[model samples]
Target: MSRHFETAPGLCEARDTATNAYVFNQTMLRIKDPERTLDFYTRVLGMTLVKKLPFPKMEFTLYFLAAIPDSQLEQWSKDDGERLAQTFGRPAMLELTYNWGDKDKAEVNYHNGNSEPKGFGHIGFAVPDLAAACARFDSLGVTYVKRPEDGKMNNIAFIQDPDGYWIEIFSPENLEQGLSEHLGSDQDQR
Candidate 1:
């Protein structure tokens, strides 16, 4: 199907010709241990569980989570969910798909797209305070791929989840200021 977007001034909206609308609802990640993954996302990252859909026939469960509270999504239908997904500056919803047998087998592993071909790069999160977030992650024993102090991109940092997927943390103000100061007038030239 063909996809189109309507752009007016500063706003942009994605639309589908046939369907009612097209939204980037969620990014699905196949997780081995749901308990550990849920803890990492909820406790460490402070995401709320918005919806949980279980498929007994398919032998899998889908957990939808976002930074917003569950109360906000209580009345949201499928269309509302799609509209919510289109919102920018709001935390993107995460869909964790857990296969029923993975936990039982203990040997099933999901490729985090970091090795070999490296298809998926990383997911990013914008925080109000980057330093505090990094510090908290440190206290939680989260694995760091790159710290803000380690590289030229001092405003951004990357952390790895238990599944090895990289999560980038940054502040919008920090990124703007850092890039401007780092680049100076040479930004336009580059």
Candidate 2:
């Protein structure tokens, strides 16, 4: 199967119909301590643990989490491999992998990709109210890479997980309003 689309005048772009059929499945992050990371994600961030795959022989475990209810995940778990694939055809999830004995050993730590030269930037979530979320994080003692009040980008803030990976937080309304106010004036010059 093929589709022909036009990029501009006299430009015929052809592509296989199956070429772009893709969906974001999951983002995997290595964790040093399962208990502490799980507590941070579940208790502080309000995410539900959907699935757990433990490979004792391989000496590692994979935990899939989402902002979904347990009942919904239970229903999805009833499906077989093929059925599950079909059902979750476009599922977006977070996978946390923990190596065995890392929690017991104090010297084990993963590079958070935010050192001298940054690699992976950050993952983001849009909250209902940014102020309330930051307040709750303060009470929970979550580490902040950039607090809303501490930076020039006051609309968006960055918080670090137990593993030192940054999670960007913002409210959709605030972000959009800020972007509109800032970017709207630039159109006049164009």
Candidate 3:
């Protein structure tokens, strides 16, 4: 019931264009509480707070976070200008935007994109150990959308952030093995 589409020839040939230097820097999410959201990302998820830019005039603040390794931590902490340069160069960084007065509001102002309207799907993070990671999330009182054993695809799990954003978790090995098994089953059925 699924159809596969090949890349158009013209688009495939456009790889030689000058856009090669472009890198996917980050994705932004609007959050209500900086304290709770920042704690969830930094303390629970173990991402480093790379930079914090406050726009008082705009009444919002930007927080950049990345899963930086220990070795690179010292370097990123050294200088402001260099830290920002390095942060911008990295891919898959998360930007959390907090409007100054949102914390005082009774209700969350933004949609997590997973409910009724359903536009943005979810963000993913590949873990080294799926079981252990899920356990850690459990101990930290994180909310779960799906547990690995709950669905047909048992290799993946989904956890929710403080702002109700879904984060898909999986191990690379398990994901590949799951795909292989599914494909083999499809072939066997044919």
Candidate 4:
């Protein structure tokens, strides 16, 4: 299907489209050990150690990881356990703890075991800008596994966090000098 940036063609796209009227916020990963999982995210992926909280009367802890401050998310995390117990209906985020109380516990990860399924797998996410995001990864010394590639509908790229978690970034348009072979330009595909 043909896609255009603008809804009416000549005019600009709607305001909500910039941040996305919809976006996947958080993903709760099931880790054999939460501590090890923490290591991979903060140290490897470079997402700031955001927040952590104990699940009342349980051996588990809930962590909130994010690349930026999301105010709406803070409300969900800080709610009481009884409320959170009701909200775990989603697949990814486990719970939301109060930002003020949990920040102190967040820290960097030190890889100690085979991350495997214990940590997250290849998570594809959108960015504000595609090429700029890849450049940030480059500056952080994060190895770019697959340079950005343009699709018929989306721009994409791949990279690995320090823990060996593969991440793919997707955007609405083309990456300036992204990998082009993914298109039918590939002789094999053609």
The top-ranked prediction according to lDDT is 3
Candidate 1, 1-190: lDDT as tens digits: 3233432354435544665444466788988889999999999988877678789999999888787656775544466466444332244678899999787786787787888977887888889999999999989999999999988888999998878888999999878877876664434556
Ranking by lDDT: 3, 2, 1, 4
2 versus 4: better TM-score goes to? 2
- Against the true structure, candidate 2 has what lDDT? 0.80
The CA lDDT at 157 in model 2 is 85
lDDT of each: 0.79, 0.80, 0.87, 0.53
Question: Please, what are the lDDT tens digits per residue for candidate 4 over residues 110-169?
Answer: 332236435334666667787787787778677666776533434677776543446777
TM-score of each: 0.74, 0.78, 0.87, 0.45
lDDT of 2 by residue, 50-150 (tens): 66779999999998877766556555555457534633463667789999988888898877788967788788888999999999999999899998877
Judged by whole-model lDDT over C-alpha atoms, candidate 1 comes out at 0.79
TM-score: model 1 vs. ground truth: 0.74
How do the residues 120-174 of candidate 3 rate in per-residue lDDT, one tens digit apiece?
A: 8788999999999999999988999999999788899999898889899999988
